[model samples]
Target: MGLRTRPIGFGYFKTKFNDKVLQDEQDVGTCELLQDSKVRIIISQEPEKSNLLRLEEAPLIKRIELLFHMEHSSIPMSLEVDVSDTIGKLKERIQSIESIPVNRLVLSFLGNELNNRSTIHECGLHHQTHIEVSIRASPPAAASTASGSNAGSKKLKLLVLPRCGTKKIPVEVNASDNVGELRKQLPILQEKLRFSLPSNGYFFIHKQSVMDDKRSFRWHHVNQGDTIEIFNGWVTRGS
Candidate 1:
């Protein structure tokens, strides 16, 4: 019996012959790939780091604590409000808690009457700033009645921006009207409009706060030409 030598295939011979060259190429390729991957990781992280830096550099919101003094009272009342709050808004806060009529309340800082449209910061109010509170004297009964009636009868053009619609609905309403009364008119308003309004229960938002159904537009600080956002759901508090 003739014993044949074990045959070495051409593939095995080539691999063994070029082992060092293949290994060198693979090592260089791996180093280059690793360097590319590291560069990509660093580039991706730069944007995130910049975003964090920008956030850190952003200015903090300042809140001002104001001292209110009533002419009749010796004690000083304190209220904290954002620097961005309007004088009208501060008056509203005082009205809600102190039971003062917003229309009659007068706010004065440094002997200057603060306008309703002026912001707290614009009025040169700082933390612990003292403000004088006074009530306007009541006019004659008949004249007061006539003025009140005229004011109540005046129509306000409210720009209603529904959450689901693009077209703003401008409605003529009385400032004395409540939110519930306005809700009732939505269906009637839908009839006149080309676009459909939200059919389900909805609520109104004013000054970034939800408006109560029992409160009038004046109560919510909703003025003429103010935009009221209609949201299609009920907001549950304390949940």
Candidate 2:
């Protein structure tokens, strides 16, 4: 007679760990400790067969290096900082070196301005990457003076007086007025004095023979008593 055989059932099982083990447990074939501190149980119908399996290894972590570029066009121009530096800290460093105001300065990476609180790494700055730093000139005394002079020069004042023949009619004119406008006003004098105004001629402003077409004269600079002498053609009568 052949020996009687029984089919073995194979299956996976899971369980939790505690201070006590179940006394009535009968179906469990094996147990494993998982990475999460939980217990795993395996079962098989054959009591002699081992059902335990090993856990897979975890992946390794990679380390990355960071780099950044710094640029500035003002005095004490060049600066190099870590990719971890904050924008606010950079502004403070710049302020210490140059007279430029921190508020007026702007920091940008790859042509984009960085937020005040933004870190260098947040702005896509990488190791060895170059960044452009633009520094704007603040409203200093020199800048204000220059702007004031420009505004003053724009105010219209008599640069040249309109003359009638050799009689010098003493007409008030705008220094801002072009030589062509002056020529138009002196049409009678131009005809009487045989002084046919050249289409392209020069005007004497502040003893300088500035060409009329160049637009060099500022009407605001000319005072009430300023004299503008118009030359006929290219030759001066004395020359």
Candidate 3:
């Protein structure tokens, strides 16, 4: 190679170009190289590290322990409802948490059964307050028979039997109406008869027993102005 002046490869030769053009090309090439390097770096990172940053933040939670003063008559043992829960929801939750039947459970906030579909605040419930829950057992056969007879007199207005020499007043009610609704309308009747509505009382509509005790038979489709017998043995004056 030194003896003969043979033409070398193009790589050995140097060509001159405009300074502005050369600088622009170099800048463009540098920008492309930087972009490619950045992409490679990102691809080489651990996939788990990217996923760890995207996890959602955990929510703040607070727990409260509540002691439900349950009576021998009540089946629900404990009530640990959330502060924001309603009475209805609390009832359901209590039933679920205690493994108790909902039908056999009745919740009393303070001294009264939770009515009006109110919340814990509406029922005057406070943290660490004692909530009394009572259970009502099913009446015996003999008691139910006596209750039927007593209720029958109140509905039929006919005193088939006599007790204490007091005349039994008969109340004529619709077959579809609830016995409780009739009791509300006859406040004086409640006092005069000195009887309380049973929690599990049923209405005998056309010789058929309707188990719904919340509303009177008047709300259902039955014979209009039909007489409904109300068994008053479930609750007593002092109970």
Report the number of the highest-lDDT candidate: 1
Ranking according to TM-score, highest score first: 1, 3, 2
lDDT of 1 by residue, 24-112 (tens): 23444543444434321111212234345755797976897999998889998999899999999999999997898898899998798
lDDT of 3 by residue, 101-200 (tens): 6655677765678752686666666656567655556548757775675543333221211122344445656444465555555556667777544465
Q: Model 3: how large is the Cα RMSD against the reference?
A: 23.2
Better of 1 and 3 by TM-score: 1
Off by over 4 Å in 1: 1-58, 141-239
Model 2 lowest lDDT segment of ten: 47-56
Pairwise lDDT winner, candidates 1 and 3: 1
**Pairs with backbone N, CA or C atoms under 3 Å apart (clashes), candidate 1:** none
lDDT (0-100) at residue 223 of candidate 3?
43
Alpha-carbon error at 37 in model 2, in Å? Answer: 34
Off by over 4 Å in 2: 1-84, 139-239
Residue 132 local lDDT, model 3? 65
- Residues 72-108 of candidate 2 have per-residue lDDT tens digits of 4433244667666777877877778765688877777
TM-score of 2: 0.28
Structural similarity to truth (TM-score) of each candidate: 0.37, 0.28, 0.28
